[model samples]
Target: MELTVLGDNAAQNSAGGGCSAGSCGSTDHQVSHLPDHIREKVENHPCYSEKAHHYFARMHVAVAPACNIQCHYCNRKYDCANESRPGVVSEVLTPAQAVKKTMVVAANIPQMTVLGIAGPGDPLANPEKTFETFRELSEKAPDIKLCVSTNGLALPDAVEELAKHNIDHVTITINCVDPEVGAKIYPWIFWNNRRIKGVKAAKILIEQQQKGLEMLVARGILVKVNSVLIPGVNDEHLKEVSRIVKAKGAFLHNVMPLIAEAEHGTFYGVMGQRGPSPEELSELQDACAGDMNMMRHCRQCRADAVGMLGEDRGDEFTMDKIETMEIDYEEAMVKRARVHAAIAETLAADHAKVSAPVMTVAAGTRPVQMAVATSGSGVINQHFGHAKEFLVYEASPNGVRFIGHRKTDQYCIGDDTCGEKESSLTTTIRALEGCEAVLCSKIGFEPWDLLEAAGIQPNGEHAMESIEEAVAAVYLEMAKAGKLEQAVITAAA
Candidate 1:
């Protein structure tokens, strides 16, 4: 294991290199808090920066299909296209194939900046295929930021190789530090040519994870810790995990919900281990926020996911499609550079023009949750009828925070009499049950009335406006008009 430092030339030429200050977005408070060096690493990396997710896109190549640890929450499924979760991919590619797909995605999706290898299995467990892909990408696509997500069972050994390829970002899924709680989440781990099960395995895995985290941080590589919040399993235990990882110098902490739906067929899912409720997850994140930066916008993306967060475009660049289509790496890289520059310019302009509203709310006003319909780019531009999902935000006098998103059936299918329109609208409203307001570009008369009747305000006044600003402005309006107090009392009643 030979450690190497990222060169100055590579840093300057990386995809995030040339972006102006505030180019990521207006709500980039996490990035703003970072020191200049670490800030440069995450300002344009979509997964690392919540605000950058709107402007930049990331893709994961599924080249590693081997695992060293067995987690109760994960069941890696290949050829699983319909499911959108970690460890699920339609296909696994060889190192060469992964590089080719990376090139094609970069060429096609100009906003794509970060290329990660978060597998159908662990990248560090399959070090040969993993590092080979990274080696090639660093040579061919040096401008694209490279990252890897591992279970950390093999991370201590891979850190040197990771740094050798100029890979600056690493994600370690550290579910629990206590072996007792860990034994509940991970059943077995293959270590030292033998299968270790139960508490012994959990202890080794935890030790490796903590050591790898410290090793990566010592080398100046940005580390983001991902924890799955299982209701009875590790919910309360993750706070200590967060505190420990932050103490080890992890740059960010992402506390994601466990996807234990029985349909996924994992051990937890089949055994009726339920995931945390949205409220529970939010409370845990808030608790951990006192320790370090909490990542709220994770989509728990697939191994081969393409495009932005909350969206997948992997179907467009399948192996068959890549074989048929011709790609000119040099030319595409030039075009990508230009597109990134243009995006930075646009974001800078948007930030300068739209100042965040100042809200003078009465004391003790509860935070209001609002849903915004947006196709992408962090604006309230999507029409109500056209939205397949609504981005939910919680606005307080402190600031606006993206809590989660609610998926709903599309309301306005092209005019086929809309036979199921009423049912769809009902379901959509039900999905947005807690939200007090829905902001979008337009809403029809019928749905508008229905939303109002349900105590959810439908407002189209802030079309094409920044989502954070619009949410805050709406909250201020509600506070000024005495709606906040009434809503709280009504809910109480």
Candidate 2:
């Protein structure tokens, strides 16, 4: 049978076979350049100041795109689900050839510590190709780590083979433990040369997969689980996977964001109609956190990616490279002019105006925009003296602050000042009215509407606990870039 490889999506946690062909980097692109204001805004985002906080340290190469089982949600037309999981296959390679591609990648990226085989198909289902490549790599480049992600349908049979090859890590995509929901996602399971479904097949598959995880871990292999955080399909099941796999010795839990691949010819389009929001994604991650390490930095690289941070690799990747040379002295460069364009367009607008990009609430929905308010002759209320329920999850530049209700202390506006305003619904609304954005655990609709109307951006989607801390991050970044004095809020107040 002919095999095809489709690039992986967002971060390779889901979509297709997890090759992430869609998000691959350009071989010789330039670093994305941002305007001063946009750069300041970008710096405020955690990725810039504390990137280590969200990095995943592995890479993948797509070898096979064929699957033995037909999942209700399964769309194996593409070799990888990453870029657009259900698209037509763009590239395909055998395991030996895939390894050669990976070695070329390892040379350019020293931090790419682990190598994985994810596919257009189930990695274990194509055991010979998967293990054959692993065996070859073991002999040619013994120092590099080997990893594989599978559907778990064929995992039990491939366990010994993987162990024999000294494979160190594995990522399995298990959505639900219950057969009812399982049936919706998985159409038919091949067992005994017959198609099985309902609870029987689900039970058999989950049991064997779980047992295989135990066996693999028993052999001293590290296990990582990639669970899709699909809202209704198996939202609650995530906690269970975390609980079960953690018990079975899985070390890392990568709760991936589901890609809503439009027009990728597949059953998923007919099965589901939407994708998860940033807020919803955070909710699953928060709910699923447990003893298992959660991987946040998954770039979901392509099956042939060869640079750190999913930066593009030039022509360095090939089937021959896998036989030798695990590291590349020079890294590949990426050009991000388009990404920079988006950032600049949003930032250069007057922060004070309620523009299209500005924070603004729609007629019927929640605050749909970040209305950039007007800079006024009236005194600026940077800090609302009224301290309400404040909670700080992480540390920030501004000393300790609250995420819940508290008494407001510092009123920086001109003297003859208003006493510390009581932390009330009115005060919350007033505070958000003046601030560009507010990041908190939750907010009331009353305050949300007021903030949007008054030109404040409600950063309600983030799961962070500290607002001042994030603000401080923005401050420090501007300071380091030599733009702080003019760009930052003054302490004199």
Candidate 3:
């Protein structure tokens, strides 16, 4: 694969005086000059921001189910429906199935902002499946963020592939920078079609991981290093790994504890290896916290995990349930647009005497279009991410009328593939161009930001069953708040 090492001169003049730690420096003046694709890395990614975590949610699709390395701590199974760990998924989904499930999840869980390809196995080991899912998502759900976690054996060869897909976040499991320490953690690695074990495998894995880190950081991709804390095995060495990755421009370091449940069937558990105590884990995190940002809130989610951290909604949108629903590919571009355009014309003739709403729903008083996230009921009952289509209506003194509906691809499919001219969210925003307000039972930070950026009001509140009733209630609330008049004055000014 051909690799492009960004020129150092560009970095010297780039944001934050050279993109320290693969993050935009204090000044985004330089970043503003970057292409739109590059500027989008940090917007609503929950793992990258503490604030985003509270408001934004993320999910992982278990499309890749193969591995090139064997760690004593790993024992992946695909048959279990309730196991909640990295290698356990209820079912293995094809790229297409994964995309479908992601769409449904995103529509139902609007707060979901990032889509990752974590695994029942190494994502890079099953590169075809991983990239195929990514390619499909790029074309379908361009607004969502893409991320991957790897064991680092194939990272050097896969870094360019990640960039090609516009994937900006990468997590590499690096328990130690020392090969001797690594020997205790990873038992064997498949290299060049041969099984390499002991210190040789450790050394090779370490070299590739470091090289991949340097290359990723140079390309301005955010990197997070994950270190598993196994009591008496590389636990004391993670601090040094933290120092190494941080020096190589890692954005964050996550020190996770080994899950060594004997009944779970992992090699480590079979060997009776013990996981670190809470105190041990906390001490190590603190020791390395000064060197690099330490991620304290990791739940070690399953491959098919969904919803916010600590809460798993994977069972709700399983393949069996997803197959029961129907989706229209051209729902927004054709049906919704046609209906919306006609209704808009009628509303215009009826409300000509009324001054047009001064601004989108935020300013209030004027008759502006409103979009609601619903599950086909005229009621706002679905979360922002779960709505397959948005029902658009005109709200004014004349009352609310069915305008049209805009269709959105499953957002959790993955981020758009690289070099796409427009994102799915951008397209959705354009479809709702004349709309002033968006209503949903729940809203995520990313969608909220996108709507707000387009100058539309995002109303994250529940509404009455009937569309007219909901609009009337919302309008009355806006009037009582004394916001509509202010919006009119602002618009006139």
Candidate 4:
């Protein structure tokens, strides 16, 4: 829990004086830096563009239940409603059922602009079901952006078919380019109608992944490379993975931490393998971000995730529920067009506003961490007592970069007694241990006083303001008041 200061001269230069390289900032600023074609693809994609996540939503349908390879970190589970990781879905569906559910979701949730098929299993492994869902959706819900995630063993073979269905965004999980390191992660692969094990299997998977990446890039498909940082296994090796994928025309790199909880029942989890700490993950991302756009807002969403990132509405649209709900997709598409247009107009206006002031820290000023309570849309609009989680960001001379989120119990339950409120507030304060400030729409005086006692400042002045701007404003205010220098001294003591 040491403070990792970002936005130094090097980071600012690499990030073009905006946010950290490939991290959060104003949507207009981030998009303007990309090539015209790439910008068009990511401008409204919630997962691809950090800024757009505030206003957009993405969902995945679990139609592909057959995987070709085995990863120690992955445990595909069906009928699991409590777990929120990848490869877990409540119920598997047919292509027709997937399309019906998607239309219902889109009609009800206008913010949903992207539909991805990242499965309880690899999409390409079950070609017919995956493509059938894509083909039908492409013909029916043409307005929704189509995306798929794969392990890439079958990608080269599926590329031609993928293009026919108009899939523009693809995510390939390329953990390692070296088969030696890969052998430790993947145990086996079902290739050529046989089970290939150990290093041989790893080699084939890597070759297929690299080949598939090249082919997808050649076809003008936007590719996002996802690597899981296994603490002792591929943690140090992922730097090489990032460089290799970026050289092959990958548009973005997402270095996600391994999820190795023992209860998940994965090989790594049961064997006591550990995931990276938040600080460790952030440092690795900073290292790999020298010239690559690193995605920092990914939620590692489930195969059947719905609604905005960090919030799931899958339960509301189960197969049984879809059976009863009526959907008017034609009218829904019209409304979706209007909603997208308004979002575009708002982003244009936001882009026109003067950019947030870029400050330079004096030699000894330490970076500070701040927590923001937002209900998505990149604005600090959630009330302090009502928030179940707070998105944490680090502010320094370099810029504001989202690090991760901390979960806590909501403090203001209407029926809570005084002792219960105090306990909840205590839990919240403990959850925000490293943050120097909390930014929310509103906070009660009692919690504010307690936060100050714990050396965390409480600020509600930036309600509804962009999170990055408000973070910068708070940092500048603290610096001008000499609180930053005092903080450094206080920490040293």
Candidate 5:
């Protein structure tokens, strides 16, 4: 198979080129984190600032109903009035209908400060539908902040498109970074026109997630990571999730317990996989306090959730009201499509110069394994502790061939940011034991020493290079330093 690798620099340079006026990659948060200035900006966003919950309100319009992946805990077709979880929207509207509903809701509830799309499906999956809605809102209701919640599989490619529409806040549902746990939570993901199952799917999903988060942060987008705390699965791992995303510059972390109600017709619910208790959830949030800010006011909202945090105004703006409401659909569609096409054209022209790298890895004299922490643009970019997975390649006399990856557990244990504790630290070292060398953007002294103590060469000083570029450099250096031959002898020992 031929190799195609998009360069890392293209992503960093391509951001914010088409953002709407006055919001060219600017964040609303102030210098002092959640101080008065920041609060005023986020005072109406119920999900981001805790103090905004009581007086502020938010609304989600479920315009995108097509999904690309299947979550074991989600059933999009089944919506119970008694149940409240993701994929349960009372009504799904078109881009035109959504804007009309937003107008009605905003007028009815003056407290509404933000408009979001947390889908009956992945918003990024239905990009045209989702962006069209944003285009209309940006022209009509520019004052209200626009937010979106996505699974992150398509986010890496969609960041430029999102910034073009001036999307201010984004929420990514990052359940777990470890694919062993991820394989249990997600059944399959449809990618590259194929349905990839098991750990392979999980790894691809994770790499895109970490990469997208980094790109969004670089573009000054306020990111909120939502982790569903599944008891006996990933409850204990969430604090580490918090640490890693915080390290990567996520603005906020919202850890919500899994809502596994049997009436919702979910796979986990049928299997009796229970959600964390209130106490269990609270303790996990408390454990993540010092390492990152935790959002305690999440109501585990539905896709069509409306009104304040605890209340529901979805019934007030139902399809009946939207039909009765007068709107210029033809004009709205024309404006939405016109702006969208123009921005897309400008973005295309701006990125027309970016090209993919001719990636290749040569064979070495002796067999050895190498790993890299990447943002999936084929470059070493992510911090050691924040790496979602390490791409492992086997170099032998025949040739260097793609092998597999080890989903690294986010390195911090409990509340320890530096990873000084021996237990979680030992687990990480053991996972990468036989690798001769590992390429990373940065690592702390304790973990660096730990890898060297285990005889794995830690190459923390390597500058940003593509996976092919880094592998070639490392292979040649190993050959010159006689490390590959020594590795062979050590294996014979």
Candidate 6:
């Protein structure tokens, strides 16, 4: 894998590209501990000044309905005035048309400096439109900064093209660092050699993305990570995500709220629930304040937004709007998918799909799970310990129940940021040893495999946030089924 990391050197916590990694010596937040290359990028960000950041400098043009990942929290079939949705097409502009529209809009509102393609479809999933827009803008309007948000499937190749056009900012939507959560979000991915489904597909994507981010950062591209704070899925994982991205070179962190619009039929709200409120977002920002720059001015615009923050350039975004555009949503979705597949084939050094272990739950417990890491990122101490004992596994009475993890040492021991965490695959298998089931917020490639090896079956996605609630829920469910003994036995075992 050609590892090129993308991150904002100017905004990083470390300093100097060649500095030896160590405890960040400075307590200063204004001056970055990140290497000089990355530090400069953050320092130089045009948005650094309060006067430069007005809500309207960027726009999301949702041109297609195709996306590679189905985030448990997303339904691309809808539209949000603030968040990214699947079906809402303000308009589906061809690359040429998009460029033309952007130029035209720029004339009316010159404050717009960033032209971003966030999308009803993943930008990478629509490479032709994504890149072509960049190509056109480069030739027509060189002053505007080019930005794109993607699943990172096509990023490895797209980065080179973007850099060629002097593009500076990029956003990648990363949720959980685990794979089981990924399976819940993504059904299939054209990864490795063949198309993989469920957990395998998720693993491939996470790895590819981690690799791609590194490549992007190494080349001086600025990366802002958009992490949806999915409560039960990866809420606790935020601090870790911030740490890793900061280390790898991400500049700004955009922790967006999971907008669960009922009409969308996407996630969380299926239970007729609401997402985290503004207060919750504040707490999360406080929690993630460990040397990471968090994005506070997110309007969560649709993929195809046009105009300045205060200005209503809504007309510039008139591509997929049924009232104005002629393109069908389904057709645009198909085109987007084709572009995504093509981009994946263009990037990613092909690898094989690694098989994982398949352990079952004991009689009344959740399955034992494992955490997979990207290269270089080894096991973080964040693994839930007796924390595993708290997750309740819901299965048929006749279905197997996961007992518990016998070990926690190497179970969480592995690189999450670097791809070498594969070695921990062996460690994970051994950690689960006699365990029959697994419990986790998410899973990734190799760790997914290890849990399978130890006979641990994935319990799938869970909504447990606090460590205690997860454990208590397990026993509560077992007791309700008159199977609490299994929990006791597992505790003893």
Give the number of the best model, judged by TM-score: 4
Best by lDDT: 4
Whichever of 1 and 3 has more lDDT, that candidate is: 1
Q: Write the per-residue lDDT of candidate 4 for residues 1-493, one digit (tens) a residue.
A: 1111122225354544333545544334455677677788889999888778889988899999999999998886523455667888889999999999999999999988999999889999999999999999999999999999999999999999999998999999999999999999999999999999999999999999999999998888889999999999999999999878887888788899887766667899889998887778888887877656687778887899998886889999999999999989999999999999999888878777765447666756778999999998778999999887898988877667677777674312444331144477899999898898999999999999999999899999999998888998999899888888844544444
Q: What lDDT, from 0 to 1, does candidate 3 have?
A: 0.68
lDDT (0 to 1) per candidate: 0.82, 0.49, 0.68, 0.84, 0.70, 0.52
Instruction: List model 2 lDDT by residue over 283-391, tens digit each.
Output: 5664554233344434444554444332434235545444465543223212122333443343333222321121122222211111111111111112222222232
Clashes of 6: 99
Count clashing residue pairs per candidate: 0, 59, 14, 2, 0, 99
Ranking by lDDT: 4, 1, 5, 3, 6, 2
Q: What's model 6's TM-score?
A: 0.55
Say what the RMSD of model 4 is. 5.5
- Model 3: residue 89 alpha-carbon error in angstroms: 0.9
Q: Give candidate 4's error at residue 75 in angstroms.
A: 1.6
lDDT of 1 by residue, 1-493 (tens): 2122111123322433222122222355456546678777887888988778888999999999999999998886523445677998888899999999999999999899999999889999999999999999999998899999999999999888999999999999999999999999999999999999999999999999999988998888889999999998888899899878877888778999887766566899889998777778878886776666678788888899999886889999999999877889899999999988988887667656644556578767778999999978888989999887788888776567777777674322444443234577898999898899999999999999999999999999999988988898899998888777744654444
Residue range with the least summed lDDT across 10 consecutive positions in model 6: 372-381
Give candidates' CA RMSD values in order.
7.0, 18.6, 16.4, 5.5, 19.0, 20.6
TM-score of each: 0.89, 0.56, 0.60, 0.90, 0.60, 0.55
* TM-score of candidate 3 relative to the true fold: 0.60
Writing each residue's lDDT as its tens digit, candidate 6 over 1-493 gives 2212322334442543311112111112222345565444433232321112321254555544467656666665554343333335555777777766676555444445567777777888777777778887777676566777788876786777878877777888777567777776566776545667888878877877787788888887878787887666677787787777777877667777766645556666565556665446646764665446565445455566555332235754454442353434344434434543543342221112211112223444432222211110011113332222121222322222211112223212233531234443454455444334454555556555656665565443333332222333443454466543433244343
Q: Pick out the ten consecutive residues of candidate 4 with the lowest summed lDDT.
A: 1-10
The local lDDT score (0 to 100) that residue 375 gets in candidate 6 is 10
Better of 1 and 5 by TM-score: 1
Worst 10 residues of 1 by lDDT: 1-10
